[model samples]
Target: MADLITAGRAMSRRHLLAVGGALPLLGACARAGLGGGFPAQTVRVSAPFAMPDIAVPDFRGARPFPITTYGASPDDQARTSAAIRMAIAAAHDAGGGMVVVPQGVWPTGPIHLASNVNLHLERGATLLFSDDPHDYLPAVQTSWEGIECFNYSPLVYAFGCDNVAITGPGALVSKLDGWKPWYARPKPHMDALIALYTMARQGVPVAERQMAVGQNNLRPHFIQFNRCTRVLVEDVTIHGSPFWTLHPLLCRDVVIRRIKVRAHGHNNDGVDPEMSQNVLIEDCEFDQGDDAISVKSGRDMDAWRLATPARNIVVRNCRILNGHQLMAVGSELSGGIENVFVDNCHFIGDGKGADGWAVPIDNLLFVKTNERRGGHVRNIHMTNVTATRLRGSVLAVETDVLYQWRTLLPTYVRRLTPIDGLHVANVRVAEAKSVCTIRGEREQPVRNVSLRNVTVEQLSGPAITTDNVEGFRRDG
Candidate 1:
């Protein structure tokens, strides 16, 4: 039995207008867009409002220090990070200004950001990170694939800060030796340490886990900002993330634009924004291992505790060359998610790699809730999305009971979690091997799912299927 109900709020007029206006601009700038051929410009002087704007701060009044004089060595990492931290502190101590990383290859460990600090790297500067796993040791509170875990600190990290920016036209590299895999620990002790940390975390209370600081033995993210407001990360190239890259969690008014992420390590997601509001992600390119843009929330019981929805988020004008999924929502949607919009994106699937993976490419827009943490997903709009090739379904809304049992039950399980009020429109896929499946639990049905103006060339299975869905609608 399937049910369809117009039970929730509709897309706001302002949102629709924004989406309508942005689509044509995205089409015009498709392949030969900004930054693809344009000459380098100062961050502040560049189009801060434009799609590929490089935000260079106007430090006209501040004294300038050339970084070429700084020596480069493995030992310089700690010193450079320390120097940057100190510089930011000094700037804040005497009002505020930018902390610049001038041209040079400076090695660094974990770098923390302070409020009113702009960690700007110049054109020739390369912020190279040490590959030693120990450098990221003593894990911190962070999210891995959206689940709250104690993991290694990202290359750049900030928390509870306002007016922070990581802007430059520089390249940031992770010195990953080919011999040692980026995701695997070099020594058995590191693995043991992670396991020990996880076990210790299991003993702690759920509330404490949320508030705890330090890495949570999980994979490291390239850049992460939590509980921050008014943040900007622009015009940077991030390479060889040991884990997921560029995560902004629980933040407001955040903008990530004109960033290039190239990572192939296990679970190296390009960008993940969880429990955040008013985020704008634009003009980014991703060649990653996992989802290019994944939206998530707290996992298991912790998700319920947080109960904060990721609302009013927008993603536009991005290109995904190769990734697990072009865009994804929730394997960890314990907290509700709503008012999300994605448009003018391209997904050039890795057909060979796509067929090689075991799990199907779920959906460009995936909404699933576990038995433990079921929440509402509503008001999703995708417009002018183009997929060259897809090995899986165009869309999949499923509640995997087995996955829930394996992941959610052992820790904390809840029942009657409903995934409701989903709408997808203007989705087009050139080719696919499987049908778009929409499913829900037998007891708790998936309700009010609608698809409009969707066109798929090839589908191997049913266009839509459900175990028990209520009020499902499909239009043209």
Candidate 2:
């Protein structure tokens, strides 16, 4: 089961920020047009609040340390993995440089990236991750479904690294030979999930919350930048994933640009920015099994402790071939989300890729939260978006989305999420089942939603439906 929510009328005065597609920063390969050097770049976007300019690390004049020099052999997983590890170390030790993966089909295990390193894959190169679960052993500090735990490390993992990037015209491919079966929600898997949830609620130390043990079915993410600053992922193609495809957790100043992702595995969200700040995602294409871009601020009490909001995020000029939603704002937002801007994006290819992959999208924007989540959603804007089709509404805001967790456990905290300040303009969709659905709570209704020049053709349901919403307005 998937989760989502929607906006109300008239954006709050406090919610005025960005508009076009401009950002000021040093960027990755595709953004800076850098073949091997980091150059200063700027992009502009229009929104409601003051969007901070992201700062990117400078890798200019940096030396290159190719993995082939460290014993990388084609099709050898162990040798290639060792070579990558060694090359990363060498680059980091040199103060900062590119750890280049030359053109070849290099099979490898889980890769741990270091600080001040650019894991660059040349054209025609691919990192075919191993299918064996043991290859990602000794659980690392990670999160599953918003709750923090010590789980199997992501395929490409970076922790607390500064000025890091994974950029090139190459690909990072996952082998689902072993992970495919873990997608099933078996009894053991459900039990493990519940156990982790309960432990988190009870304030269990994250170290003691080891989930890579026997009978646990929690899948690892494909790529995760954990608690890192000045990050970038650019120009690469990703195929398949064990879980959420790209996750930037608690990171600041992250830029993900000009990449392509086709991951239809369970929970394969294209990009999930959780408890992060000042992020820019532009010029990317996504075909995923779940929400294409899911913005989250962490979950429940575990997130409340950190007190960091996922704020000042911008997504521009992206194309969604297929996804559950173009964007989803939290069923796990207990730490709050604010100042998100989406502009100049579109849905393409009739929900089907050229390779025959398809996933039906439910909405353009989905804002979902339950009474158990006590976060606030504010200053969210989407402008100049076009879509061909949608299976559900164009915009949906639901206050009671629990999915499988409704019966698994009782609400540890019954604070309802406060949602406000949503604005949409110049949106055109060919068709959809409904235009908008706002199912807010009576106690604390959603507020200040405005839609200007939003047009949808062949709508099967009401243009707007509201339950406990305030200040909703639509103007041509």
Best by TM-score: 2
Model 1 misplaced regions, further than 4 Å: 1-75, 144-150, 177-217, 349-362, 401-411
* Residue-level lDDT tens digits of model 1 in 95-179: 4456778777888877766555567888987888876666764445566544554445677877666656787899888776721
Each model's lDDT: 0.63, 0.84
Summarize candidate 2's per-residue lDDT along 1-476 as a digit string, tens digits. Answer: 00100010011111122201111111221132222243434444455789887877766667999999999999688999889988887876666789998898999998888767888989999999987888887567799998998778799988777778999999999999799989889877777778777777777667667677666878999999988878989999999999999999999889999999999889999999999999999999998889999999887888998889999999999999889999899988999999999999998858666677788889999999999999899989999999999888778999999999998878878999899998989999999988788999999999999989989888988889989999999898
Model 2 earns a TM-score of 0.91
lDDT score, candidate 1, position 88? 61
Scanning candidate 1 in windows of ten residues, the lowest lDDT window is: 1-10
